[model samples]
Target: MAKRKIRGTEEAWETGELGRDEKYVEVADINESTIDEALELQMISIRLQKSLIEDFKLIAKINGIGYQTLMRQILKRFADSETKRLLRECVRAEEQEAKEQRQMEEIEESRKRA
Candidate 1:
């Protein structure tokens, strides 16, 4: 029989499974005593609007994530980081389009004059 190598410690086994082609996470099995010690310090509650709840559900479906998990990922991803970049690209493309349009108009005007 072939021996299988275990990761971390004997308390856990790790394997890979496709999560609706979205992403991967590591799940671990730890001693209940350890968990109890970790949970002693905090309690937090957050509220969300109904419409935003529905939109989050839709995004979670697209990303193959549970609603809560999707929310955590979004918060951690710092969603606004790309806004300035995308806006700059959009403005540059619009300017280039306008310049090309003016050039074409000038060419038509020259043809009319000829």
Candidate 2:
């Protein structure tokens, strides 16, 4: 069996000071005034499964966004997909109706010639 590498000591893990790397620059006080407020947000409360919420938080953290923002993005994508699907179905239905109408007109013309 391969030996697994142990993580940092308890003290380092607890203090969360693992000697900051030079590559990681700490940022503070970003001015978001330039950002456009295109959408008016409303606050609402809802219940979600604990595990699902945890997964959302983990994914949001990975993407460097808040969980609520991630959820909104996900919802928007789903809504757009559903809207496209409905539009395609409507177009197909209209095409089918036009095809049937053409077929009926051909049958009527043949009857008139007979």
Candidate 3:
């Protein structure tokens, strides 16, 4: 492995290859009317108990939002949380497997030496 000197160039930055400064941008004036519509959605019909729907509606009313919107938020939050947890577990399992593999390799090398 050899260390190499890297050349720095200002052409990439000075030529406006990067976007213009948006530090003074106003978000409230932005036309995002169709932003919600732009998001992909799938429609699926499901059967739910009346009590559940009533509970969801009550919660939604308290939150000042529609029940369906509240449901979507809850589902998205649960899914995102579970995804992060699963990813962490997967990484831990992979690290443990790699550690075991390295230990086995060391043991095999010692056996060969014997």
Candidate 4:
């Protein structure tokens, strides 16, 4: 067996062999809920066009990730961007409204002085 050095570590291990401190655990007893909880994931289902799914699968294969994971990442990015955009719009609207209110107050004060 060939020895391989782990990246960013001072440890070396033999390729194609388990370390003395490592052992494989039996996975037969593990269930979906256990995995979801460990990964902090929630299960969801949605229907999409077959063509879209196929496209995602091809892209994900090229990127070395599952299609579902790619879709989740895409959704997260869109949500974050959309939330920021909406927040900016809200701030602009609030600022305009405050400016209009100040203008109205100034007009009323001028009318009272006249």
Candidate 3: list runs displaced more than 4 Å.
1-37
Candidate that would win on lDDT: 4
Off by over 4 Å in 4: 1-31
Residues 6-113, candidate 2: write the lDDT tens digits: 467887656755545566777755445423333545557989999999999999999999998999899889999999999999999999999999999999999999
- Candidate 4 per-residue lDDT over residues 1-114, each given as its tens digit: 997854543343455334444366444888899989998899898999999999999999999999999999999999999999999999999999999999999999999999
Give the Cα RMSD of candidate 1.
11.7
Highest TM-score among the candidates is held by which one?
A: 4
- lDDT at 51 for candidate 2? 96
Give each prediction's root-mean-square deviation over alpha carbons: 11.7, 11.9, 14.7, 5.7
lDDT of 1 by residue, 1-114 (tens): 997754554345323322322345566778777885796533358888999989999999998889877886786566565776788899999999999999999999999999
User: Residue 36, candidate 1: how far off, in angstroms?
Assistant: 10
- As for lDDT, the candidate ahead, 3 or 4, is 4
Candidate 1 to truth, TM:
0.35
User: Each candidate: what lDDT?
Assistant: 0.76, 0.84, 0.84, 0.88
Clashing pairs in 4: none
lDDT of 3 by residue, 18-54 (tens): 4445875556754454555566556669999999999
Winner on TM-score (1 vs 3): 3
Indicate the worst ten consecutive residues by lDDT in candidate 3.
29-38
Question: Between prediction 1 and prediction 2, which has the larger TM-score?
Answer: 2
